[model samples]
Target: MRRLRMGMIGGGPGSFIGPVHRIAAELDREIELVAGAFSSNAGRSRAAGEQYRIDPSRAYADVAALIAGETARADGVDFVTIVSPNHHHLPAARAALAAGIPVLSDKPATATLAEAQELADVVRGAALPYALTYTYSGYPLVREARARIAAGALGTIRKVVVEYPQGWLAGEASGKQAEWRVDPARAGEGGCIGDIGVHALHLAEFVTGLRVTELLADLAAVVPGRALDDDCTVLLRFENGARGVLLTSQIEIGELNGLRIRAYGDRGGLVWKQEEPNSLTLYDLDGGCSMVRAGTALLGADAAARTRTPGGHPEGYLEAFANLYRDFAALLRGEPAPLLPGIEDGLRGMAFIATAVAASRDRAGWVPLSV
Candidate 1:
């Protein structure tokens, strides 16, 4: 199969997510970065292209020019990856799809709920392959957890608890990352919830294969002078008669990427932690507990397919991110790409953010999800 070419929008110098996207896309040797509008500034974009060794002609001034120039070229990119801020996600993806190129976008879909719905409509109408990078679901162990739950190893899930905490924004805003995240204009209605809470929400739903039917949220701006909520706690009711809790905060001092999930069922319970990505712990009802490590024979077919090394060889964030790219590339090659998060997941995330914000605003008891 031919190596797929990729173009990127955003992720220029000092940008947090752009290099991660580029690195993940290129990890498996299935895709190459052929072009990019790396930044809003034309000079930075060109400089980023030079740093990546891309041809100057392909490095356009902005997203519009990148889409136009690449589309006109015979060797244009096969797909476009949007790593821009949340506000740009909708427009960038729309432009790519309209130009007949597929899109792999960063999470939360759009800056607003209305835009997310419209984007969903456009993608469905276009009938193209559009994927959202819910990076946590790419882990081999996470896949193993999902497979086990689906097989009823954890029978009749009754409770779920997920949390994501970080201290990066605990103090006064000092960096570019903190600046946009705390600003409602760039990050949308949610601050911490939109940034990391969605990841926690998506992980819980992805593993249990259950939909959150309704939720009650208490969101707060913990830090002084912050415009958006830096702390959030949500109570969830699932379609399968399950109850859950979600906690996400950027002001938890000394905590760093502490994302974890636990699901309890009638028969057993399972626990997974993001910082310790290689292991999953399961506890049976009969006082029996076992730790399942990644790359082991216990993993199912989907998990084994995603595993890269033997058990005890640690694989963390970058590898997980790469798995999504690998699956998307396989999909573009017309092969089976099960478990890749697509437009529906993106839409669901946006809905969750919107609903949580509204629920918090009104102090409503439990708001049904309107996705």
Candidate 2:
């Protein structure tokens, strides 16, 4: 198959997610970084292009020019990826899709559920592939956990608990990383919940094949003077009558990026921790304990395809992130959407964020979801 041409918006100088996106798209060898708009600043966009050997002339000033220029070119980018701030995503994605270009965006679909719903219409109407990167579901073991649960290894899921904690906001962080995210105008409402808690929300549903129907939440601004939530605890009711809890925070001092999940059923339970991505611990109803290690010879093809290197070589965050890119590229190349999280998944994520925010008011009362 011919290599897919890829472009980007909002991942220019000092954007932590841009380089990560580039390297990820590069991993599958089926994608090529042919062009991009990079940043709104002309000089910065040119500089960002120079790093990838894109001629300065094609490095446009903004999304409008990027879409117009790239579309008019003979060898236009087959698709675009949006890695901009929360508020910028809807416009950028709409432009690319309107121009008949596919899109892969960072999570939280849009700044608001209304915008997300509109974008979802565009995606469905255009018959274009749109994906949201929920990094955890890209893990091989997480996929394995989903498969096991689906196959009845864990019957009648009774509970699901996911926790994502980070130390990034443990104190004030300066520079591009912390500034825009903490700024309500750029990051949208519900800081910690939208940014990280949504990740946990997506992970639980993706693995369990269950939807969170109603939630009671307690969202807090643990950071002394922060404008939005930095800690959130959500009580959940699944469509299947399963109960769940999601606890996420950005103020857990020294915890670093710790994401963990535990799902239990009448027949068994399974656990996976993001810090230790390669191992899954299982508990049977009869007290049989087993560990399913990644790269083990006995696993099925799905897990094997995702396992790179040997059993103990320590493939991590970059690889997990890349998994989303690989799947997106595959789908853009005419394959099925990667069963992980995509645009619909992103819409669900936005729903969780918006619902959590609404629930947080009235002292974090219960909110019913349309999912």
Candidate 3:
């Protein structure tokens, strides 16, 4: 199988997510980093591209230049990974798509719902494949959960509770990660809700195949006078009559990306924790409980298929992220993609954030979501 020649738009020196994106894309051995525009500053962009060992000529000063030059190359890249800030996603994606290259963007697709809608529309009309990295959805256990729910193993989906909490922003690491995220101009209409809450919301709906028709939300400033929401909670009404609650926060003391989800149907419930991606807890209505280990003796095909190593060997965040990259590559290859959360998921996530933000402003009142 020929590997996808990949290029990146962000992940310049000292950027956190860019490295994560690189590792994930490389993990499955299906993508080769061919070029990049890594940063806004020309020097930094070239330096970051050099760090990846790409030819300096391919490390252009800006996204448009990268698109122009790369598209002209005989062996151009397969796609561009947009790991820049929320504000950069739209322009970068538009450039790539217009150049006839696919895009795999980091989440919250754009800074605003309107922009997100526009991107979705463009991608839909272009008939090109685009994916937003709701990374947790790429996890094996999460896939198992989806499989079970779809197979009627869960019977009737009833309730979903998902929460993602991290404390790096609790005090003040407010340097790069916290700074760009809280900026309305760069981060978009929603704050913590977009940064993490949307992940929780996506996780729930992805697993249960439920659509949140309406919701009520509470956006709180747990941090001292942060410009954007540092913490939030939302109550959800799924189209299938299931009830759900989501809490995503960056101000939780000592919390570090502790994302968890639980779904209860008429017959049983499935619970998975991000910290331990290799295991899922299953609870029967009759009070019997069991743990489904990723590499254990007992494992479903969906779960087993996603597991790359022996049960004890840990395959985690990087690997889950890699699964998404691999699946997207499969999609581009015209092969069967086990899974890929496309532009539709991106639109719904943006709508969730917008609706939640609106609800939070209206005294934590219920808000009907339209998508």
Candidate 4:
């Protein structure tokens, strides 16, 4: 099979997510990194291109130049990956889509809810394939959990608890990632809520297939001298009458990407953690418990299809992220791909961030989400 050519907007020197995106995109041998505007600085962009061994001519100064140069080529990139900070996601995506290129963007979709909606409208009219990298949804065990919940194994979902805590921003840290995330002008109205809480929110909705109808949130800047929130807690009311609690913190010491979710229903409950990832614990109403491991016969077709290793082996973050790229490549190849988070998910996530910010600011008890 011919690999689809890809261009990236960011992931310059010292960047975190760009390399991850590149690695994940190439993991299945279905996508190739052909071009990129890796950084804002022309020199740095060229340097990154040199590191990636991309043709010198394809290493443009910025995303606009990359889009122009790539689109003008007969062998232009088949798609564009927007790995820039929140502020750049909207423009890069808009340019790619307007140029008739497909887009795969990092999470939160855009800097704000309005931008996300605008992008969603453009995508809706374009009829082009666009996807959001809600990375956790790509996990095999996560799919297994979704399948179980959809199959009514967890009858009448009653409650959900999801938390994502990181210690990287525990103090006054200065770096590209930390700088943009804590700046409202760059990260939008939310900080921790937009960064990690959105992941928790998406995970809850993705696994349970329940939309958050209303939410009440409390956001705080835990670190001294920080402008944006470093910690937040949200109360969610699902459309199916289920209640949920979401907690996200970037200032929690010793917590390293501790994303965990648990859902309880009338018949049973399920728990999955990002740290372990390979196994899901299922609790019966009868007080019995069973552990469902990934790559096992017990997994559903969707989960099994995503699993690569056997029962005892492990698949992790990169693999889960690769699933999204792999599925997107399959779609571009005119093959049937499993459900991947699309423009709608992007809109919803942005809405969640916007509403949570509003709730926190206005002390709103329960704000109804309109996305």
Error of 1 at 56 (Å): 1.7
Which 10-residue window in model 1 sums to the lowest lDDT?
173-182
Better of 2 and 4 by TM-score: 4
Per-candidate TM equals: 0.99, 0.96, 0.97, 0.98
Candidate 4 local lDDT, 25-68, one digit each (tens): 99989899999999999999999999888999999999889988
Q: List the residue pairs that clash in candidate 1.
A: none
Write one digit per residue (lDDT tens) for candidate 1, span 263-295.
999999999999999999999999999999988
lDDT of 3 by residue, 297-352 (tens): 67777678778998889888988899899889889988787468888888988998
**Least accurate stretch of 10 residues (summed lDDT) in model 2?**
333-342
Model 2 agreement with the true structure over 343-369: per-residue lDDT tens digits? 678778888888888878776577798
Write the candidate numbers in order of decreasing TM-score.
Answer: 1, 4, 3, 2
Where does the lowest 10-residue lDDT sum fall in candidate 3?
169-178
Off by over 4 Å in 4: none
Cα lDDT of candidate 1 equals: 0.92
Model 2 TM-score, 2 decimals: 0.96
Per model, how many backbone clashes are there?
Answer: 0, 0, 0, 0
